[model samples]
Target: MSRHAWIDASAGVAGDMLLGALLDAGARLSVVQEAVDAVAGGAVRISEREVRRGGLRAWKADVSALDDQPPARTWREIRTLVTGTAHAVFERLAEAEARVHGVDVAEVHFHEVGALDAIADVVGCCAALEDLGITSVSAGPVAVGSGSVRTRHGVLPVPAPAVTELAKGWQVLAGGDGELATPTGMALLRTWAGVCEPLPPLTLDLVGVGAGGRDPAGRANVVRVLIGTRSSPIASSLAEPAMLLEANIDDLDPRLWPGVLAGLLDLGASDAWLVPILMKKGRPAHTLSVLCPPTLADPLTDRIFRDTSTLGVRRSPRDKTALDRAFVPVKVGTGQITVKIGHRDGVLVQVMPEFEDVAALARSQGRPERVVLQEAVTAARETGLVVGAPMVSVWAGRAER
Candidate 1:
């Protein structure tokens, strides 16, 4: 059962445009409307009109713009607005934006996002996500418009400072005129989206096209979102990665080596390994490396630097493109355990037991860890599942000589 969702920004996406898109994608308009009413802090008057984007007719979401607008906020005030909204992943995203901009959350006022309508966009999208029960969200590469537009703060460049700041690491292309991807849009995207990278493997179930406001004339201004099924069992996660953490250390203390390897794994490293290499002056130095998921990358790196003698640590994203992996329950010698198996295409490429489960069973039964480990492996092999042949071609490693 593969499931996935995709956002097509070929026409540029906006807040309201996204809401309309969700509605078109099978989101109950009534449900979305009710949620908007509550979050808008007043009666949210919504109207849907049949519009054409790049010659395709679609429903466009439009909320009445209010005259009694809130004051223009910095990234700080905008964050406070987001905080008062909800505690879902969206809230965390608002907070992250504040941290990125180096401002107090609440004081960060709304720029393009300060208006009541913008709030509608956020709440509407959030409500729709909840309604859809979407576990994963991804986007096609976005084309952030260039040039300038008149904003609450005055006339500013196309990818407004706020938008630019919002889309820090996201993949954005170029655009022709008016504000394409707004700050509110960017914040919503960065907060909930899993990856802006090329679409990963997914089994297609549905295709959704979200209509954007104002067709950019001679181009697609509609934000098209594809709602399909994920082909793998990989889960979505985050890591507070150190964007640029690196230090070339030539210091070596063999007595201090054991702690680095053992401690880092405990501290949450995807992998911690070493390579022998010659230093600048031909001195021997172990190139200690640590690979971690984004969330744990920074702290683990910091731990290595602070706890160890390393002066600094080089850090970057360590994104893992996992296969369609799953764990199956197995019983061995009156003991039951789970084994994780990785599948690519459809063939079983790898299999391993749950380390903690095996260790606990070994400890409880007062049996040697090796014996328990072997039992678990044997059980899995006897009753293990097989993946598709295509998967085997991609992931099955060569047998040992």
Candidate 2:
């Protein structure tokens, strides 16, 4: 089973604090150290110690720079040192900085965040996640502090311009005084966390509390991580929040509609389709509709604007209910075709052969597509796979295959 990590950043989140929490949560220190060493080029060392934050015990991770004055690195320079998720995190940071300064991403150079210790924190946290086999990550609403903070660019308001840019789609609050969430922390959260919401249903396994530098008077001043296996799928299947984006276009090339729909799906829209409609001036236009998760609404909306000749796009919230689905392969003559099985309450509800597979089989064997689809369905039934049949039949049929 895959493991999930839920970040409790209600207090705040920092790169060092997040790293400490993962370390406290059973990620091997050696694994984190090795990854940090590789990325930081041996210019930094990280260590963790138990500490008290508002009387709550937590792990405090400290990254110390070995070089007295390490050379300032540019976004391009840092981009070359990291790969995969770590690289993505830095890319987000660079983009945020560019947006804040109104400059090109390649021209942005590191200030405080580009330091060796910050590099260690980001790389170590990423390594710790891989070490713990955390496949998914989610975070709660973040608390970005208030008041003024002095930066290399002079005094700036709390939640720094770069941090604000990175927090585009995330939920945030002004929790307390001073800087609570740093740019590095916001970049990490925006890049790694797939969803920002309250705790979801999960079978609790491990908990780690990571302490921030200051132990303020009231709150714990720490970030908490809860690792666990996700609970029942039924909770996720019913009434999930979704978004519907629609635009009517008559000027775009007719042939581009297919590619526009395909592009939406490629960009993470759950479903994209077109509906024919007549505009006010008797212009026959197509209404492009895209269904996607709420998190993707912004990007998909932008895509609609860029891909089609639409002056306006409309968005509405929707409740989407989905079935529990599975796939099993069945023999269609000499070729094997995959069938989709939908279940509800542990009972089989629908069974259909995947059309793409059926079409491929038809073309390969010089048979009509309809004939191949029929054979695939017949093979499924012959193996005891059908609507209203026990789902156990699916497992048994797989065994035969």
Among all candidates shown, the one with the greatest TM-score: 2
lDDT of 1 at 336: 79
Q: Give candidate 1's total backbone clashes.
A: 37
Query: What's the lDDT for residue 303 in model 1?
Result: 81
- Which regions of candidate 2 deviate over 4 angstroms? 233-235, 238-401
The superposed Cα distance between candidate 1 and the true structure at residue 382, in angstroms, equals 40
For each candidate, the alpha-carbon lDDT, in order, equals 0.64, 0.84
lDDT at position 245, candidate 1? 35
lDDT of 2 by residue, 198-270 (tens): 9977888999898899988988999999988756656545778999998888888998988999999999999
Q: Please state every model's RMSD to the true fold in angstroms.
A: 15.4, 14.8
lDDT by residue for model 1 (143-253), tens: 788888886557887877766766777788776677788766766665556457666566666555667767666886777767765444443222233333344556757
lDDT of 1 at 212: 74
Clashing pairs in 2: none
